[model samples]
Target: MTILHLALADDWTAAVDAGEYRVSTLGRTLAQEGFIHACADLEQLRGVAGRYYGEVTEPLVVLAIDEELVGCPVVREIPEGAQEAFPHIYGPLPVSAVVQVTPFRR
Candidate 1:
């Protein structure tokens, strides 16, 4: 299994096309933890920024992760070498464009 952290909707869509079960955002499901706001349009992301946190003025960024390929327990404790590649797009990311399949959580 491979967990792919995406910074854009297209990224997630591409993964789906490639035959993967992408986990909806944390906002969509409670079992899925974290916040990702990336959308087709930049404005949509900006509009929803407030819903995620208070006292916000500028647009926010969001991303999605492929949970099925990613494997269990949403959260993870990543290692150092892998950490450099997986820059946190939003909250704590489980994978990245360059990195995947970290030590599983839970």
Candidate 2:
């Protein structure tokens, strides 16, 4: 299955160079947040983007991760104040697990 993570263009570039991604969300890291947030579908991705990245003007990209290729655990859990569950990767995402990278537009 494919899961999507919204990422800053620069971060993604860094991940490409480093071989792994550790950002958990905007302005946060995997070490700080403990997991990398991901969307299960495009609709969910839209909601997350609107809520967290609405005012940001920086270039963004969507990393389409192939779950089976990810070495870490992918858990589905509801975050605080949310009615639905989101996929959370419990370790740094390896760049090799990302099947596609698409530019994001608001």
Candidate 3:
């Protein structure tokens, strides 16, 4: 399964520049969240972005992750009231697993 993660373009660029992608959120990481949050599909992506990042002024980037190369657990579960289950990677996210990344705006 290919999962997607919405990341700030600056964060993504910083990781690419550092040769590793460790920051899990705009301020935290897997250490704090226990998982690298991602979405199962495109529909979920839009809602997630709008709900959690609607006010973000910086550009957002959608990271397309090839689940097979993740080398870690990828679990899907719905939150308390969400209609859809989301894929979450339970470990550090390796940049190599990201097969593609594109600009996102809303």
The TM-score ranking, best first, is: 2, 3, 1
- State the weakest 10-residue window (summed lDDT) of model 3: 18-27
Residue 52 shift from truth in candidate 3, angstroms: 0.7
In the range 10-67, model 1's lDDT, one tens digit per residue, is: 4444544655423444334212634332332224334334334345333322443444
What tens-digit string does per-residue lDDT give for candidate 2 at 17-95? 9999999999999999999999999999999999999988999999999999999899999999999999999999999
Which prediction has the highest lDDT against the true structure? Answer: 2
* lDDT winner, 2 or 3: 2
Q: What's each prediction's clash count?
A: 4, 0, 0
- Candidates' C-alpha lDDT: 0.35, 0.96, 0.84
The superposed Cα distance between candidate 3 and the true structure at residue 2, in angstroms, equals 1.0
Off by over 4 Å in 2: none
**Candidate 1 pairs with clashing backbones:** 36-62, 36-63, 37-62, 38-62
Which tens-of-lDDT digit does each residue in 1-106 have in candidate 3? 7899999998899878776666666667778878888988888889888888888888899999999988889899887887778888888777888999999967
